[model samples]
Target chain A: MVEAEAELKRLMLAGLAGDAAAHRTLLAAVARHLRNYYRARMRGAPEDAEDLVQETLIAIHTRRDSYDASYPVTAWIYAIARYRMIDHFRRHKRRGGDHIPLDDAPELFTAAEDQASDARRDVMRLLDTLPAKQREAIQLVKLDGMSVKDAAARLNLSESDVKVSAHRGLKALMKLMADAGP
Target chain B: MKTDDLIDALARDPAPPPAPPAPRRMAFALGAGLLLGVVLLVTFFGMRPDIGAAQMPVMMKAMFSALAASVAVPVLLQLAKPGRPLGWRIAAVGGFVLLSAGIVGVALIGGDPTERFQLWMAGAFPWCVAIIPLLAAPTALLLTRLLRDLAPTDLRASGAALGAVSGGIGAMVYAMYCPVDSVAWVVTWYSVAIALCAVLGAFAGARLLRW
Candidate 1:
């Protein structure tokens, strides 16, 4: 564990000094660790765990300057991860557990279909609350599964702008969802 | 989006342009804020008419305010970054508070009992408390912006520290126009004003400092 901490710290410091390759390596490693951390805590919700892993990684990347050399890199990463997880749970609680399971084998297929459509409806409703650009960016890139290049071309925005809008849109969605809850 | 794809996107984005070290950035921000506060001070209140004759008290006020700022500035910088142990810095802030209290205690004990109330109230009680925070506004706003750029895990604590440091600057500027020489009055009212700034900072920080 200590060796892992040292290696991660070294990579993080190098990454902060404009070493893009080192940053990529560090992020990949951090993502692996976050997956396990969230998976263990969020049993039976692998998709949610993956979503959190992505959210935490984005946070770590955006806020990299906040990292201080005096502390272990894992400690800093986990602190951010913990914050994201708490935020996730808060939003999750507000949404409430509305999922219903149909146990009969004959109904199982239809139930899955129903859930997917219900999820799509919920997403569209939430997306409507975002700014037009953010909503469009997320719809094309995230929901429609378009590449950033394609989405950017369609929207007349730069590729980075598409990514940024999607990121911001997701953050806003989380906030909106949390507020929607009691 | 898949986690791996998201990672790739994040990595592909360019690294932020190089930033000045934390201490340098902090110094620049606070210095600029102080300059604004001083400009406001001179334009409005002007220096105390008797500033030349009130050298002793003015110097004393400057010393106390400077000491407070010295204690707060480092801690504020420390709190702006995450994962650093604040044990010693927190202790140092506690020590400064004790020292301020000690000065007040000595003044109260050594002075005549009949003048105790006068010493506490001194001149410009209302103005001191009100104007210090008013002057601190620029510094507080600047520090908040800086802290947002930097990562602060505990928003409320960071905000309170920001407030305290700005309040110190405000008190320092207020001292130039404050003619009261009583150590008790300076210690008591200045501390109160600084605390008020801190409370306001905590409220603002909690709302504004989220990542």
Candidate 2:
């Protein structure tokens, strides 16, 4: 993992030179890389998370040759993952549920007001009150299957802070749900 | 909701029917780009000395390169995939801008019909390097959306390849209608200009257009 990118470059050069076997080998390894890449980014459940990885891998395999040798493969790969996540949210919105924002670009923050509505109506219905950022941390890390580090990166907070936030968010949410007295 | 419960809520939600109307809009972008490429081509041929004249190869070589870049930029931007899908308005906008680039090239090349068009190419050739993307964002968005729709299992590569080729056609079309007679001239001056537009479009789309 430490020298993974360097190794990938060597494999890519081999593929460019028309090594068919090298291309297959590189493709297989990148699939694993894609899964881990996605896992860290998502802060949700395990089930759909793997599906996202597989879908992204399919995208990479289908379009691998387009990977510019001049660019970093890792960022290119993550960009694909990020788009798929957006696609996922769009699909979810169609199903009558709340959607999440995967804000990779400034232009993509369309309908911030709508997302806020969704947060108040749906997310608050479940968690009672834990503040927006705390709820987001729980949503991204616990349910979305994103690791603390990746969620922290997305949230622009230290990992320790996110850990604390998630802890508090979960505790408060549980108490709120429990107090509903079912 | 519990974490899994929330996940379940999201998962159980049904995906909407495929937005079939979107593809037609995307195809429209492809068509617009193709039209622009054809325009470049037409202007380029119009600039040729005459249909029957013996065409010199060296000048032809330089002209073709210029023509190719002008064409590639709009098409490449459309085919790029960084974010949400592109729409028809974007395609229409790109077509308009690429058309303007062809017009600009026409102005510069319409002079001195006796001069060999290729010689001047070396001097003003790389200008397309700056303009293609700057003024042609709609075209870039068009290309990006076009590529995403063409993501078929087997024909994906074909989609990308066709995008580049067809885009060149649109650029060429714009070139031909430039009111210039020397194909070499249009290819020399105008082709270089549009190609610069294409490069700019692709670079901007990479970041600005990414989802």
Candidate 3:
């Protein structure tokens, strides 16, 4: 990563200083980098990656003056790339398609807070396949953050019954997640 | 589009972007804005009534505005880069500290506290609020144009920073022409006016600065 950044910086500085060959070299390098970047995330959707790469390249061409020489050139390039990716997601969402973004800001991959929420949603969807009593017991005691006694009171069952249902539900959920994985 | 063809197309001579990088463009935009602000101040408002004789308080207001501008200028330059953390806490906290000092100074002068508060709230407050945004219009437009094609990851924050610097310049120019000399008034009301411009700038920049 460091070497790539250094090479990009050198090419960018040379390009900015009116080196046409170096400028072409910089654009080609960035395009190659962006292709790998979008391809890895897009997976089965390879066409989207190509489109994103082209949009990103166009942005880089026009917005070259926005680059600050004090910082690494890769930072500016990636920032533009990230914005284009976000816009891509927005367009896809608007078209009534949903996708799990594989990575968030490649360089500063901070694991977006929404990832945890998405996992919770997936777990809940899996939980719906469980028997009704078990699902309710587990949701009350686990998902709702309720005590066993409180869950039993709400379900009109004994605490031990609630515990038994929850334990059985968790065992079933383990199987469900494993089965859904493939 | 094929990567090779696109790259070859980009490699053409016109591919090299225009001169003056992001920092220099921002500097030019702000410099031109400040000059225009000064000209507007001289033409519209004129200097304060006691320019030659009233030495201490009038000059002090100018000093405060200058300090405000000094803090905001570097912040503006730093925020031009995409994804940079805006360390604006110091500028905000420092401005408040300066205003507090002025308030205390006003207290030390032994005026009636209630009446003085009313006076500070009343005198030139609306005009200060009105004029700073008016002055900031040209700066905001220039900064937006300069930033139009650039990738500012945090659009609103960049706009706010630009607005803040413009507001500081506006305050400095307004100080020259303002009739009210009280430090309390300038610090409180002028700061409010400047803050209003910052908010306006942030809103405008969010919509205008998108690539």
Candidate 4:
């Protein structure tokens, strides 16, 4: 991990100095890590999490010059990632709908190790049927690792809104899955 | 879609930018930071014209403008950037530019350093530094959304790492540009201010800016 950071910094500096390959390498190396970071925020919504990862990588590339040489490179990346997450919450807020509590979600999906892959996909599809707000809450709290308070705060929403959204998302998921299952 | 496929899709389809001319974005940042800093400096002078008696014209205004740019540039850029979160980099750029400008304007237009020691520092400077940035809350929100959006996948570690780097950079940038003299002052006050700003920018961006 430490070595990776060093490499990232070296590559970052190199990229800033106009090395295209280093820049590309820096972005690719960090891409997966960014995805995981976004994933945790996504709660249960891998799709949304993935979206964040891609966005952050691009941000890093364009804004690389703003980085200060005196600081540790790792922390800077985290700061950007953190800010992006906040943006995610605000956009959903303007749309005005409920979000789900993340905790309620694992319970909903814990049943299938065997069919987990397709089951998860089905769950996501069912989730897609609901209002954008409710779906987002589930994606955040349930799929992502964000604490309810943190997630609620991010969304600029009351905890209840987060909770209700998760509930509704889950209910929608169950209904859709039940209807399709044998 | 598979997670990887999903990510590819997201990466592939960025929102069309408002327009082109990347320089325009940088210019806007410079402008906003300059404007905000100038206003704050002017106000600071007005509120407590009794600070000292003016300082060095060249250095002071330069310093003030620097501060303002440090805060404003990062914000405007963050707002404009497609995926980048607006936090320390944007804040530092805005704050530095604006503050530096204000410092310069004061020295140039206000008067000479008649030793305006701590009067203004004790009065309006605090509020200008503390309260004013809230007007641009949207910048932080944008950053947060960028972070939240990236959190759920392979990018988590890099994100955290990036946050740390940006925080460190914020501190370094403030240190590099601000005219604080003491090492202890640099380590204690300046560094802390940088960290605080960086953290605030990131935290606000993460929560307030979520997409």
Candidate 5:
């Protein structure tokens, strides 16, 4: 574990120096650790765990400059991950209606182990909450991995409209997932 | 999106323009806050008219707050980054406060018993407390905004440090206009004002510093 932390610290320092490849590698390694961290706590809610992993990765990426060199990289990463979890719980508790009582025998629900498909399904589920135009725009441009121009042509909308729709859709999806806590 | 796809997109995105180091950024915030405080001071509370004769007291008062601010800046900078040990920084702050307390204690012991009330109240107590925080607003806001980008883990402590720094700047600026000459009075009332800022910062930090 100490060696792994040293390696992560090395990659993080390199990433801080603008090495995109090292940053990518650091984030991937962090994601694997976050998966286990959240999975153990989230139990049956693998989708929620995956969402948290993604959210934490985004935070680590955006806030990478805040990582100081004098400290262990794992401690910094753990602090950020812990903050996200606290935020997740706070948001869920505030929403009140959909709060999952994870401490109360979360194992009662069959633990879904196939997280890749679970994540795919989760994305689809979140996409379903958007308006039809936005839903289609995101589906074509984001999920299907089509260019904005191609998605615009397919949806019979202008390219800018497709881009705007996809942007708004993603923003809305993020809000939805933030509100939909487990 | 799949987690892998998200990672790919994040990694492919070009790095953001590098931020100035925490110390430099904090210096900028302090400088800007002081400028705003000066503007506010000139507009509302004009400098004391007997400025030439009052120079000694004003210099002493300003030095007191300025030294506090100097100690606080390093601590605040450390707090901006996660996982940085703050033992020495916090100790420095504590030492500054203890030194101030010692000065006040010495003044009380050496001075007349009849003057004790004057030393504590300083006649301008209300103005001191109110104007210091009013002056602090600019620095406090700027420091908090800077801290949001820095991703401080201990939000309340970071906020308190920034607040104390801002309060020091506020008190320093206020010293220029303040006519009071008693060191004990300055220490007592100014410390109260700075403590108020710290409390306010703690509450504000808990709410605003979350990322």
Candidate 6:
């Protein structure tokens, strides 16, 4: 976790320096973390977790300039995420809706774990449906901890070609995942 | 949008946004508005003519307005940026409450008790109330501009704080021309005007600050 935090901070700083790859990597990693973060907090409203994750990611992009370099990157990200959650709560409170059940404490904990595993399975299933080349490209570059350059060298492809494959693969997966949702 | 699409859209923006210096930006905007308010004050209402007799009262009003401003400015600066700790928020509220209570105490000791309500209501019935928010308009414009790009977590509260600060600065500008010498008048009427601005700011912030 400590190493992950440090790596995120480094990638974010690099992103601020106009490194697009770093920016993409940081956002991808942060999205996973945020999914877990919101899932833990939003028990009854499991669906809202994904929405909050996207909102936080967008906020991180737009408000990148407000981030102070002196602070821990996770601190900055968590603050924005927390604020976004508060906004969600405020909106729901004003509308007189209760998606977050305070009374179902034990059930919420069980539901959170079940939802998280179901989400992981759903993601894996989405990845499984992609073309072989694109799936290999994504797994090598994104899931298997291989740099695009190394992954390209291993796959006997150009670096840019590998990047395009991974990018398309992710986009396709997102569309598939969204379509597969209830 | 899905997280991936959101990420793609974010990375697609070519130019890296440089972090804005929030405090300096706020100061510049409010300072520019203060200059405009001062110009208006001198042109229309001119400073109180009796400088000798009005020294202490003028000084008191200045102190109160400035103190309120001092508390509010930091709150605006801090709240405008996410991830910043609002330790100053507590201090700001404490200072405001203490200052208000102290003003009441002064009203009790130095002020004529019988005429306090009369002076508070009568001296600046409509003009003092109306003028502060009018003067705050320019500063509010400046604030809105500065806060446009920045993300405030709580828009309503941040807006109210900005409005209150703008009002305090406006009242300070008005104090130079206001002839009323009573502490009750300055505390009561100026506060009402400032509070009105805060309410206005809350509504405006809620709509305008939505990202």
Model 4 lDDT tens row, A1-182 = 35678889898788676666676666667876787677766787776676666556645644555465666777678766876676556444433223547765554443344346544644654454456677788888989977878889988899999999888777766654454342
Off by over 4 Å in 1: A1-3, A39-48, A85-182
Task: Give the proportion of true interface contacts each model preserves, from 0 to 1.
Answer: 0.44, 0.03, 0.39, 0.01, 0.56, 0.53
Q: Who wins the TM-score comparison? A: 5
Per-residue lDDT tens digits for candidate 2, residues A1-182, read 44677877777667556665565566567657756766776667555666665555445544454455665656556667766676556545534324544553442444465666544433444542356577889989988999999999999999999999999888867654443222
Question: Candidate 4's error at A116, in angstroms?
Answer: 33
What are the clash counts of all predictions, listed in order? 0, 58, 0, 151, 0, 0
Q: Estimate each model's TM-score.
A: 0.74, 0.34, 0.63, 0.33, 0.77, 0.66
Best-matching candidate per DockQ: 5
Q: For model 4, how does the per-residue alpha-carbon lDDT over B22-114 read when each residue is reduced to its tens digit? A: 445445433454344445434443323322433343243334324433454344334432334545664465455455345444643443355
User: Model 5: per-residue lDDT, tens digit, A22-131?
Assistant: 98999889988999999998888788788789778877887787888778988888888877787667544423234557684453343333335455655665565466
lDDT string for model 2 (B1-211, tens) is 2332322222222222233443366457756765554454444344444433533532443355444534443333434433222356346545645764575467456756555344344334343333332323344456555554433221232233333333344443333333334444444454445444444434443333322
Best by the lDDT measure: 5
By DockQ, is 1 or 2 better? 1
Arrange candidates by TM-score, highest first: which order? Answer: 5, 1, 6, 3, 2, 4
Local distance difference test, per candidate? 0.81, 0.50, 0.72, 0.49, 0.82, 0.78
**What's chain A's TM-score in each predicted model?**
0.56, 0.46, 0.51, 0.51, 0.54, 0.53
**Model 3, runs deviating above 4 Å:** A17-22, A39-48, A86-182, B14-18, B21-28, B38-56, B83-126, B149-151
Report the C-alpha displacement of residue B74, candidate 6, in angstroms: 1.0
Whole-model lDDT, candidate 1?
0.81
> Worst lDDT window (10 residues) for model 6 chain A?
A89-98
- The alpha-carbon deviation from the true structure for residue A59 of candidate 4, after best TM-score superposition, in angstroms, is 1.2
| Residue-level error in angstroms, candidate 1, position A108 | 33
Q: Which residue runs does candidate 2 get wrong by more than 4 Å?
A: A1-79, A82-182, B1-3, B19-25, B32-138, B144-170
| Residue pairs that clash (backbone atoms under 3 angstroms), model 3 | none
* Model 6 chain B: lowest-lDDT 10 consecutive positions: B11-20
